[model samples]
Structure formats: structure tokens, C-alpha cells
Target: MPHSNSKCWDFCAPVAGILFALAFAPFDYSFFALLALAFLFACWQDISAKRAAMRGYLFGLGSFGSGVSWVYISMHDFGGAGALGSSLLTGLFAGFLALFPALAGYLSVKITPINNGALRFILMPVVWILVEYLRGYWVLNGFPWFQIAYSQLETPLAGYIPVCGVYGTGFIAALSASIAVEIFQIAARCDISLLSHYSYRTSLREVHRDGPLKNLPPLIMLLAVLWGAGDLLRNTAWTYPIGEPIRAAMIQGNIAQDQKWRPENKINTLLKYKRMTEQYWDSNVIIWPETAIPAYLDQVNDTFLVPLGNDAKQHKTDLIVSVPVHDADPDKKYNAAITIGKEEGMYRKIHLLPFGEYLPLQPLSGFVLDMVNIKLGNFTPGVINQPLLKAGGYPFVTLICYEDAFGELSAQGLPDAAYLVNVTNDGWFGDSIEPYQHMQMARMRAIETGRFLLRSTNTGMTGIVSPNGEIIAQAPLFQETALTGTIIPMGGMTPYARWGDRPVIGGAVILLLGLIGYRRFFRMAY
Candidate 1:
């Protein structure tokens, strides 16, 4: 009630936002999201764009800074950079990411009419989603990790995921939060008057009669209808089997990043994989993690390939494995995985990690490895339209590390493939929950497509994921193990896989345009 207490509340507001985000992490307390929404609502009461943006930024900083601290482990422990450099890099990334929430908070305050609770509720989710979509594609490359919708994966609200994707789930969550905030405001009698330094000049008795609550019933009904439709879509079977089941094996070599590329360790790495695969030689298809070969295909010579190829052919097995490939014309290198079976070909990774794979503003080689102590620092981008691989008589989409996490990429590439195959090296993050979180994103992709997803990771979380976001099989973290499973390939597209995020993005754009038009034509006349 006092100014000093209000200041303290303002300072503590970001704590709610941070806790809400942390609650979504793997093995986290999800109930904190309720407190997060309350804090946001309190800040909304202030009705100042600047203050709202500041609160949002502070929240974002805490949310991402603590949740994604695993980035430091990758840069410092695995990338060969020291602790100070890793911390600096991680700080810069977190600071940049925080700006998106700042923008969302500012827009939410600017467009919301303080007296009109209905407008506030409607606009907040729309604005939040618009900012999130921008964050997914605004920079050199976008990082769409740990979106709020992801927290709903294990909840009944998860039904919304297939229809609108993660961003859509986020919109619903924000909308729910806004509704909760409005209800709180009404019950507490903390109206817009609380926001002003001078108050009680206007009688609330008359104002309350003509306010936004009059339209609340219809708005609530609309939300119920939309949520019902989402649930219906979730329960409906929109896809069918494209072909018979394919028996597959995913090998988890658990190779250390530091030792993976070492010449001295090459024999051991090769033998380890060979030994693991020998047991599963009868599998229709077998997969190894990203860069499992750990050397350029050209460097291997026939000495390596002749035996490997002949063995696969003799066993009548399809081996899908990753190796580095060198392009001579451009004098560039690429991280690639090729399928060796009845037919053999390669798929190069289209998206390269900025500093890890290639250096910016340099000649694509030498500089990054020399300066940053990271290995494999000269990979080139793959061709954009590479087709899905045909292995063991089934077409399968393949995604390398970090590639499967991009919803747009998966939507575009996986429709034609009978199922999705993701190979990654999560040893870079050590034993952090990051690997589990990353696997969860892959599961979301599966639900979006209605296709079974097979994920093979080096040093952890390797598993088979079904179309409903269920983990069919998985290995323990940091283990040298192999898993064999039967997966049925499905046909027919889920709403998301066919249409992608267009519906959600288009809805956001239309909402924004309509808001602009409304303000211009019907300038609030009091």
C-alpha cells in the first residue's frame, strides 16, 4: 500500500518471471508459473511502458541466465576456452536473449487500455507471441530453446502442441496468465487508480459499470471453444502407417569431445563402434551419433571404407553414419552423415554452429581452431534441398545436432520421410539436464509431425520417441550402449507438419494489424 513497499515489489517482480521459467526446466517445480503470472500482473498495474520493459528484461535475464548456464560448460570445458571467456560469451548471449522479453513487455503495456481488462487480456498474449516469433528468426540464426509452451508438454494442454506448435502453446499460456491477472485485479480492488500518484479524483462507482468486465463472459467462452478444438485435434488420428515397421539400432558411443578427433584415439573409437554394431548386425537400419566417424571421409581412404562398406553389405544392413566431408571447389569442409546400404549417398548439415563449426569474417578455416581451441572449426553449409535418405526400403529424414531443434527445418524436411532420425553429440554439455531438455525438443518435433522420431546421441539421452511425445526407449547419460527397437513409419501429415507455424504467425500478424486499425479508426473517445 505504501510507496516504499511498492518499490520493493517492483524490484522483486522479476523474481516471479524467473521462477516461472525455471519451473519449466527438466526435473523442476512447475507450480512456480502461477507466481510468475502474478508478478507480471502486478507490473502491468504500473501501466508504464518503460517500467514494464525493465521488469521483463530483468525477468528474462534471470530466466535464461540460470537455465542455460550449460552453455558455459560447452565453451569452457569442451570448446577449449577458459572459464572467463566462456562466462563472457554466455553473458552476451543471455543479454541478447533478454531483449525479446523487454520488447514483449513494452508492447503489452503500450497497447493495453488500463480501464479495459478485456483488451488487456486479448492483447498481452498476442504481443508476447509476436515477440517470441521474432526471437525465433531475427539474428545471424535464431535460438528458440526453452519456449514456455515446452512446459506444457506433459500436461493436458499439450493437446494444443500439434495444432499450433510450441509458439501456439506459449500464446495459450500467456493468455491464461493474463486472465488470472485480471481476476486478481478485480478481487483485490486494485484498479488503474493504484497506478497514479494522485487518485480518487474520478469515482470508480460510475466507471466500473461501463468497464471491460461486461464482455468477460463471451471472451471466456471463446477461449473454451479454442481449447476444445485443440483437444479434439490432439485426440484425432490424422495419420496412418505409410509402410511396415523397420527394426533399427541407435549406437551411443559416449565418446569424449576432446578425445573424439585425436589421432591416437581414432583406433579405439573405430573399434568401439564396430564392436557395438557387431551385436546388432541383423537390424534393418543402424545409426551412429553426429560425426561418429570423427574424420573427413576423404582422409579415411579405402582402408577404412572398404571394410566398413563390405561388412554392411554382407550383413544386408543399412548403416547411417556421420562423417566430415571436404569440398574442393570452395575449399570448404562440412559435417555430414551418409547412408551406406543398397544405395549410398550423403546428407550435409545445412545449419552450422556460428563459432564452433565456422568462423565469421574469416576464410572459413584455421582462425577459429587457432584462437578458440575448438576442434572442427571449418565446416561449410550444406545444400538446402537435400532429399531424405532411403534406408532399408523406407524414406527417413535425418537431422544432425542442433538441427532437429528447429521446428521450421523439421517441418520442411520431414513430411516426405516416413519417420525422423536425429543424431547428436551431447557430450559437449557433460551430464547437465540440457541433454534431456534438448531431447524433449526433439519429441515436440515428433508430435508436430505425427512421425516416430529416432534420436541417437553420443554420451547420453539416446532413445526412440513416438508421435505422441512418448519416449519409447532411451539410454542413460554418458554411457556406451546400443538400443534396438521397431518403429512403424506413418503417412498423412499432422496440421503442424503440413502447414507449419503459418497459422500461428499469420494469426499474430492479423491481430497486430487489426489492433493498429482499431486504434486509428476508433480513437478512444471519453
Candidate 2:
């Protein structure tokens, strides 16, 4: 390749990354992801494995740096890290995330046969989705934010949410991107002489391979089936309306973090939520954001909890609030969801944030986590496989903060949960896009599970989401507002709720390895 040509590919790499970010919320031109990915694949053409990795990293850098820039705000503004230190840490986190894509790109080019049709249209997508899955499952406790599948919630591919989880949608999205490149490559060699010459030579080299366009029909047919099935699933009521709509109020206390837990401010926090909810007494369900009480469960019980629960019961309304619960280890507590009215049960958050919830490699990371107050740092992870909380005559479960960001973890509650709830305090990220992104991911959880989701947040994005991932009503950012809406309780499980992502991801792995094996076996024998 000419130096100028290579320069063009390098220059366009970050643009692809930035374009990929637009596929996600706040700027959801979901279809742009295909363009970004197809452009990226084109850039990789005739490139060495190392160059592919370099391009992938650059693409990832732009994607994560822009998409998750809110991490810097959360760290510098709220987490208490110094300006320079926070910026560096944020960059490091993004850089680390970029490595997964870098690795995927390198491995993909290396393992995939030379411009093989199957590799372009199928193998690369598997590798990308697998890398994302591994990255989410590996990084500390896990951060499942900003995945490619999360971007496809609007596309027909979203119909696959139940059957394959978000990863399946992502796989299709990636494959589509590759197909775009294949089509373009074919167009570039429009002359039959050029294509025939190239095809005849490549045919001898590739195993189970035909001309790129020749193999394209099956790919298109596969997409048509998956997409049509997704469209069908979109209209299909995997979960049916089970009960009458319930009046729910999401109370945003709007308590400033600095003044949140001061003994002097305890009265203020309690009274703020109390005063706000006093008017919503007629509502069947009232909820508070994560850690709305700003105190330990026992500490609040004497001064507020018991009285609040009794008041809710008296009003014939069900109230759910988030509070820190004292664990056996005093230094480590639980970020617990405790209910106090018509129906009562407790759910502690299972997927803990690495640096935020509990520092990994504590001795080293402890200092960084301590940059800010980290009031809830060192919190314990909730027990896995817990039953859903019952409220308002419907079985539901709560996802604390960004727990809903991971569809698989949230889906664990299954067919038993009729509605989903998310309690978060996005004030930590100020007025950035975090709240909207969080809300977007939460909405995906509802769609994946075939249930409605209620988000109660501190300082914004509090709303009601439908089973189809639509926001019914949402509160304004940084505002002290109560969001009230009626949500139908649904029953029955989507395929995702019953099977999770194992089947989808597992099939990708098997197919990818099988393709590699088939290629290798043919090379050895022939």
C-alpha cells in the first residue's frame, strides 16, 4: 500500500471511532454504527496484523474517550481525585477498554484466512462480540457500558434482544458492517476480468470459499431471517400484561452529595423525601433513588425508616427506598434496596462497581478510590440468584445504579419479575450524558425481559420505560421533581430471561473456532 493510502486509513480510524459513539444514546443515529464499522473493516484491508491492532486501538480510543467522558466528571467532580490525576485515570480506563478492540482486531486478522469471505462476513463479528463480552466480564467487577448491542436497541436487530441478549444484536450489527465492506470491495473490482482473475487465484487458497458476493446471498438470507424474526419478536408479546396498571412515583430528593450524610443534614434528607412523597400518598407505589436516605439502615430506622414505612402503610401506598445496610464487616456495608409499605423485601446490588463500589487490588487502588469521599466504597456485593422483591401486587427487582447496564445480570431474576426498577444517583457525574446513557441501558433491560422498568434517580433521568424500550415519561436533569406514571405489570419470560447470552455467545465461539479449524485442516491436507 502507498504511504499516502495508509495515511488515509490512519486518519480515518478515529473518525470511525467517533462515528461509532453516535450509535449510542443522546445521539442515537444507530445506523451510523454500520458505516463506522464498515469503514473500519475497509481500512483493515491489506493491512498487516499489527497495523490492524493499531487502527483498532485508535478507533477504541475515540469511541470510549468520547462515549464515557462522563467518567472524568464523576472522578474529578465527585470522586474527589485531583484534576490532573482524575484526567489521567480516566484516560487510562479508556485506554484499557481500547485494548479489547485492539486485541480483537489483531486476533481477527491473524486467525482469519487471507481476505476470506467467511472471515469478513462472519468471523470478525464473532470476535468483536466475544471481546466485548470478555471485557465486560473481566474488568474488575465489570463495566458493561457502551457495548455495540446497546446501540442497536432501535434497529430491527433489537428484536433479537430476548433470544441472544444485546450481544446477538451486536453480532448482527458487526456482520452487517462487514457485508457493507464486502459489497464495496466487489464494486471496486466491477470489471469481470479483474474479479475473475482475483477469484480464481483466491479460490485455490480459501477453504469452503466462493466469490465474496457468491457467499453474500446466504449472509443476506441469514440476516433476513434474524431481522424478520426480530421484527416478529418486536410485535410478539413475550410477556403479557398480568395486572392492572399501578400508579408509581419516582421521588428525586435532589440532595447535594457534600451535605448528604452530615448528621446535621440527616434531618434535611429525611424531611426532603418525606415532604416530597407526602403529596404522592395516593399513589400505589413510591420509590426513591439509590442511597436517597444517605444513612445506614439501622441509623435511619430509629429516626426515619420505621415511621416512613408506617406512614406508607397508613396511606395504603408501597414505598421503596435505597439505604446502606450494615454488613457483618462494619467497614464494608451493602448498597441495599429496602421496601417499607404494601409489599416488602430487600435486594442488595450484586454487580459492584470496581473503583466506585469496592476497590480492586485494594492496597493499590484504595488510594485512587479514596480520591473522593467514596462514602459507599468498600460496599459488599449482593448474593447472586436472590428472589425478586414483591411490591404493588407484582413481583419486581431493583437494579442499583448501573446494574441494569449489564443485561445478563439483570435478566437473572427472570419470568418471576413482572416489572423492573432501577435506583441511581447520577449526580456524581453532574449534568453530563451519564444519566441519559444510564437510562438508555435501563430501558434495554426492560425490552430484554419483556417488562416495564421504573427508574428513580437523584438529579435526573427518572422515568417509566415500556417493555419495548420506550420512555413513557422522564424527569428533567438536575431537577428536584417527582415522576409519576402508570405501568402495566407483565408476566412471562423472554428467551433472554430464560437462557441469557450463553447460547448466542457460545454459538459464536464454536463457529469461529470451527471456521479456523476447517481452514487449517484443508491447508494441511491440500
Candidate 3:
């Protein structure tokens, strides 16, 4: 039937996935990711396309299962789904996410040169990145948690972000891991005769004692050169300060999810935020977390918003707060951030969380809203293009919660928007690593855009990230506090903001074409 050892490799897939997840925030063992990727490459090498696809599927299950485990906490603990139901649903979601990787693995293996070592190595990285890009670009409610480049944020590879975006940085990372596998294959004295079944699968791309092994030293040196280049470019400034820095404050409410939206707790929530906002009136600007107000803007406009706006104007400060805005239909209700006082503007969220905010399938929207017993469940997505929100005389691109994760999407206001403001409610995730991971993603966006990113969150990670992705100041998780800091508005744009992910995808396409051309023309001539 099947080779006995093949069964063992199947289990290794999940372990490899776990190692990859361990590379990101909360774990911070980035070296483990290389090992994990190498293990996956090793496992797939020489295996049949079907077998490799199966292994890849298992790898994805492990990768997303551990990396996004916080999803379970959100669904059951906060959304009120039963533990068993949450676990099942989370499993299904991960399963769906896994298909992207599986698609890459299957297609990579299905391609010709199934026996060519250099060709296969080249193909793997290109295909992997193509899949990652597709996963994020697809309208199927993209969940780009822990992009490979994100793990490289602190590494020299991050220097590639401004030049090529996350995908290009990820390409370098994936290539390094693949090269490592190649090195191991060469050093282990893996001659064709002495080779095991594992080596056979990988041999098409690997150097045997006399074949591709001779090329290893040069390849290694090339890798060293790439890494050295990244290190050199890592700290270079892409954007500069324009006007005077403005003092800003981020208010973290630490509101519990279950009690947050209750009609009884609505007044208390407003009072809590109001009291906190008044304390920060001395600052040039005050920011409240996403959905900081439990009620719609209309419900409190006369009594709360107008008065707060007047007080903020009188105090010479700008106040921005998140609450619901319903023009008509509950399904048309929006998750919006409105600025009050000196510079007033409203930014409704464009990227929305499916099922969490609004069900993608319109028919189920009402049923889910009724079952969830939540007023904001049927919220709608915001407009595509809106001018930057002016706060403290600086233009800020405001992102709601998960929108910051999509760097390119956040850059839509670029070259015009001077800074970034992200408001999120991480209370749904409880005191888990989700907030930290989310904040890390937000920081990367700042680095990419060459603009300061200020994040105010409900129950945690209220902080300021500098243009270079460094955290200047942060508040404790699950704390009711205000994080105040001075942020300079930047005038110029980073390469990433000016261009976007186009360069990366464009380069990938060119490389893929070259590979295809070389394989057909050069090999056929031989």
C-alpha cells in the first residue's frame, strides 16, 4: 500500500506548523521558523504530489490552529458560543485557511521539473508567496495573521519592507530556509547511492556529492550578501518630521465584553469614557478605543456627543471616539470613529470582520444578530475613499480594529495622510496574546508607511509606535488607563506607501516567467 516512513512524515507536518507559529510574537523564537520551514520542505521533497499536498494540509492545520487559537476565546468566551461549538467552528475555519497552502504545495509539486533540484527550490518560495498574497487579496474575508514578514520585523530582512513590502521580505525569509535545507542535504554526504527515500523526494533540487553540492558555497555566500544588504538598509529613515509634535492620549477602558453593551451598562460606559476624556483635555488630542461608546451616536448626540464636542473645543483639544452610527437599517449601521471639537471628522470602517461584525451572507445577518443578542452585530462596511481625519491640525488615516493588519489597505490615504490612528477593542480576546500579536502587526504598518501609528484599544495595548516600528510608549494590558505621548506628523512617504505591494508581486511574476522560460528553453536544448 504505502511506505511505512511516509506515515511518520505526516505527523511531522503539524510539528513543523507549530514551529512556524512559535516564530512570531508571544513566542519570539524566530529561528524555530526556519527549522520548521526546512522540516516542511524536507518532508515534501521527492514525495509524490498527492503526498506532499496532504503533508502541506497537515502543516496548515497546525500553523493556523496554534497561531489563531485566540479565535476560540473570542467565540466561546465572548460571543457566547458553547465550547464544543466554538472548537468545531474554529477547526473548520482553520481548515478553510489551510486550503491556500495546500493549493501552493499541490501546484508546486504538480509543475514539471519535479526532479530538478534548483528549479524546485526556486518554485517553492515563489508559489508559497503567491498563495500568501492570494489569501490576503481574496475577498473571502482575508485573515493574514502573522505574515512571514511580520516575524522578520526585528530582523534585517524587515529593511525590505519599504522596498518590496511584506511578501518580498517573506520571499527572502523563505529562500533562506530553503537554502538551509539544501546545505544540510549537501553536508550530510547524501550521494545518490547512499540516499534514503527522503533524499529521493528532495533530490531533484538537492546537491548530491558531485552534482549540485558544488554550488552550495556560492549560494551560501549570496545569502550572506543579501542579509548584509538588509542589515545596512535596516535603520535608514524614509520619512521625516514636518510640524511640531502634538500631545495625544489613548484611552483604554478595560471593559468586559459580556457587560459592555448591556443597556444597563451603557450610561456607566459613557461616564467612564467621559471622565477619562475630561482628564486628558489638557492634551492636544484624546482617542478612545473602538466601540468605546456602547450606544449609537444618535442615541447620545444631544446629551453626550454635542456636549463632549463643545467641552473639547473649549479646552482647545480634539477628541476622537468610536461608537455605532446607524443611518437607517441595522445592517446598514456602521462601526465609526468620530472626531469632536477643534478638528471634526468621521471615519467609518471599510474592512469589516465577517460574522463578527456582519455576516457576509445577507440572509443570515438577521438570524445571527438575533441569536447573538448583540446590537452591533449587523454593522456594515464603510466607504472606500474618505479624506484623512484632521486631529490637532494633522491629517490622520484612521483604521478600525483589524484594518491595520492590511498594510496596503491602510496606506490608501498615503502621501496625504500625515499619521495613522488605529482604534480596536481587543476585549473580545480577553487577556490573551492576541492583543500583543495585533499590536505587532500595527507596528509593522507604521514602519512600512513611514508614519507614526497610535493605537487605542479596549482592555489593552494602548500605545504609540514610531515611524520605524519601535514602540515609544505602551499601557498595560487589561488596564483602565490613558497613554499620553507626543507624535510628530511626517510629511514624506516611504517607498511602501508610495508604491505598495505592486513591486513584490511584479518581481515574483517576472521571476516565475524567467523560471518557466529557462526550464523549457535551456533544458530542451540540453
Candidate 4:
């Protein structure tokens, strides 16, 4: 049977979800995440586990449906999927992501009901963050988008990134939300008690006599400490700059997605990039966006890259550019980044975008995608332990497209990698917030590794991020321009770069186990 207030929670849940999406980039109302989570946590209270899960699913729908709506643009506008097909796939993708939060709500209630105040507060936040961690790394080759911690890059909670990475920061944020709801429940005791299965009228009357502010001071203090400590930590430098700043330039070609891969437009595209590069010959290092050369590496290696390399060497400047590599085996092609002039090296992308780079589940996914008239690449994955490529005489890690979203992957190149370079072509999702959201995630990587992040993207958001996650410089969206910035290569690793996500995830696992043990002991004791 549905509870009396189920309708209210059902309505509020999705609204809260929309607010949650607003807390992230482009909208960037950071505190809205806290409010949204608090509302959702409050909704979970006094509801059946099933009802909670349903409301959570609805919240997920609202959040991802709005947050990642740009997926439809990429599929329909660029990938040739019609509007109906694109909408269906986008909705399906959002629906699938919603299951993560549904699992969180269900497990949270089943583990510890809301009536047990102290236990519920701790267990619920732990369960929520563990589920978030799972959704980020374990599911679907890892889509770490819209993780609550990403929204906190501008907040003091960003201080937690260098210490414990995204999951840990997210855990703190979830804990803050849960605690806020508990504080409200304490203040408005009767309202929550009336909604629940139990009648606490007499108990509330006694508590009312004592006043509602009895238990709030400790929680308020704790909240202050968490945020205050984060602010203090923000000033702590985890990595130190080691050498003279290198003058780097990033070229944004603003190539139209539809015309980018056309055979006839290849010459024009090459000429445009060459013309842009010729102007920055004095820069210590110059970068081009992903697959700047629309054709295969072999097709233009002799006629184009060789002459460009010779010119770059003559000018004593290093060039870093991305192109598709056609290996001897046709099936072994890669989306690779190559360094020329002062050094010659290549780093093939290790983490391939599922469906975008290659279809998983082989013939099954291929057939389904074909039915929707959506075409995807069939690129090969590179080895994980590939050597770092050098630019401007400094060894740096390179990420192609969305790979920077995986913070631990950026850390893997650490201590050794002096700075970071990410080449992206966000042109597929035209005139949308996807590029901005992507840039936000990339900034989080710079914080985690304490290294300058040089992101060269086609069409929009070509920029440089400092070690502290601030944008040093940015090129305007949809512009044919070059972003010039100074990058000081840092020589130390942030705690996150050294330890990765193990401590945070391991702590969550231990807390969950402890909760299970406490539940069993409580049952036995009673």
C-alpha cells in the first residue's frame, strides 16, 4: 500500500534531482547539490524501502535526463541517429544510470531504517557514497560524470580532492546532507514522527518541553569543522613547481563536425591548422586538438607531418598533435597523440570510450546500434604502461577526450609526469554544455595530480588549468583561435596521486561491514 505522503515525495524527488543537475557546471549553483541531497534524504525518511527506491529512480531520471541531455545532440546531430532514435537512446541511458541511486536508497533503508537516528545518519551516507563510487568506476566502463564531488570544485570541499580523491569528497558531501536532514528532523520532531509508522507523540511532547535545540550544537560544530578544515587545506600546496615556465599554445580549429571527416575538406582543415601553427612557432610547445588530422597517420605522415616536424625543429619548438594511427594489422588502429621536433614519441589512448570508440559485447551491440542508424568507431585500446611523451623538454601525460574524467588514470602518470595534456574534440555535441562540463572534470584532474593541465579541444573550451583547479586561460567556444598560457611543470604528487581511491573506497567498505556487525549485535542484544 502506498503511504499517505508518497505523492508528495514522488513530486519533490524529481524536482530535487533537477536542482542537483544545476549544482554542476554551466549552471554551477554549488549549494544546490547540498539542498537536493537533503531533500532526497528527507523524502527517504518515513517511507517504505520500495517507495524510497521508486522516488530515487525518479530523482535519477530528472538529474541525468537534464544533466546529460546533450547526449541526444551528439547522437542526432553528429552520429546520424534520427531524433526519435536519439531520444529513445538518451532516455534509456539516463534510465540505466538511475538504477545506481535506486540501489543506494534501497540498501540504505534495508541496512538501517531512519528511526535509528545515529546509525541511520552514518550508514545512509556511507551507503549512498559507496553506490556512487560503484556507479563511477564499476559500471559501463566507468562513466564518472556528474559525481557530486565534481560540483564542489569551487567549494571548500575541493580541498578534500588532494587528500582523498572524488569518492571521499563525495562521502563528506553526502554526510553533510544527511546530517542537515537529521538536524531538521530534530527541530521539527513531530512532523517526521507523524509521517512514520511509529507514533512518537508522547516522546515528542517530552522533547518539546526540553526544547528542540538540545542536540544541534554538536552537529553544527562538526559541520563547521568539516568545511572550515577544507578551507584551511585549500592553501596547502601539495606539489611544488620545479622548473622555468614553458610558453605553450593550444590551437582550436573550430571545425564543423559534419564537414570534419569529409575527404574534400581534408586539405582545407590541414591548411587551417598549419596556418594557426605557423603563428605560434616561438612557443616552447604547441598542441592541436584530437584527430586534428582527420585522415589516418599513414595517409599524411610523409607529405604533411614530416615537413611540419622539420619546420618545428627549425624553430626549436615541440609540437604535440593527435591523429588516428593505422597499424600493420587493420584491427589494431588507435587514437594516438604524437610529439615531434625536440622529441619524438606517441601515447595511444588506453581508456577507450565505450560505443564511441568501440562497441562492447561485439556483434550484439553492433547490430543494435546499426538498427538505430548510429555509427561508432572500432578503435583498439593501447597498453596501460606506455611511456610518457615529452613536450618542451618535460615528460607529460596525455589524455584523449574524456579520459581526463578518470582522475586515477591521470594520477597513474604522476610523480613522473610534470604536467598534463588533454586533446579533445567536443565538436560532436555542438552548441551544448557538454564542453563546459568536460572542462570542469578536467580541472578536477589538475587538482588531484597538482599539475598544470593543458587541454586542447576542437570547437570549444581550449584552456589551461593550474594545479589548484583554476582556469588560467580559456578560448571562447566555437572559435578558430589559439590559447596561449605559461605552464610551470610541478615535481611532486598530491596524496590522491600517490594513494589513488583505495583509501576512500576501502574505508567505505569497512564502514559498511561495521554497520552489518552492529546490526547483528543490536538484534542479539535486544
| Predicted model with the maximum TM-score | 4
Candidate 4 lDDT over residue span 399-454, tens digit each: 99999989889998789999999999999999988998999999999999999999
- Give the distance in Å from residue 10's predicted Cα in candidate 3 to where it truly belongs: 1.6
Error of 4 at 523 (Å): 2.5
Candidate lDDT values, in order: 0.77, 0.81, 0.83, 0.90
**What residue runs in model 2 are displaced by over 4 Å at the alpha carbon?**
1-5, 192-226, 367-376
User: What's the CA error at residue 223 for candidate 3, in Å?
Assistant: 0.9
Provide the clash count, candidate 3. 8
TM-score to true structure, per model: 0.89, 0.92, 0.91, 0.95
What tens digits encode model 3's per-residue C-alpha lDDT throughout 56-165? 89999998988888888988888777777678767877898888778777866766365577877787888788888888766467777867888888888878877777
Q: What is the per-residue lDDT of model 1 for residues 212-305, given as tens digits with 9 covering 90 to 100?
A: 4444555566657766766676687767897888999999998887788889998888888888988998998999999898778887737776
TM-score pick, better of 3 and 4: 4
Q: Global lDDT for candidate 1?
A: 0.77
- Candidate 3 — which residues are off by over 4 angstroms? 1-5, 190-211, 328-331, 361-376, 513-526
Among residues 3 or more apart in sequence or in different chains, the pairs in candidate 4 whose N, CA or C atoms overlap within 3 Å are none
Clashes of each: 0, 3, 8, 0
Better of 2 and 4 by TM-score: 4
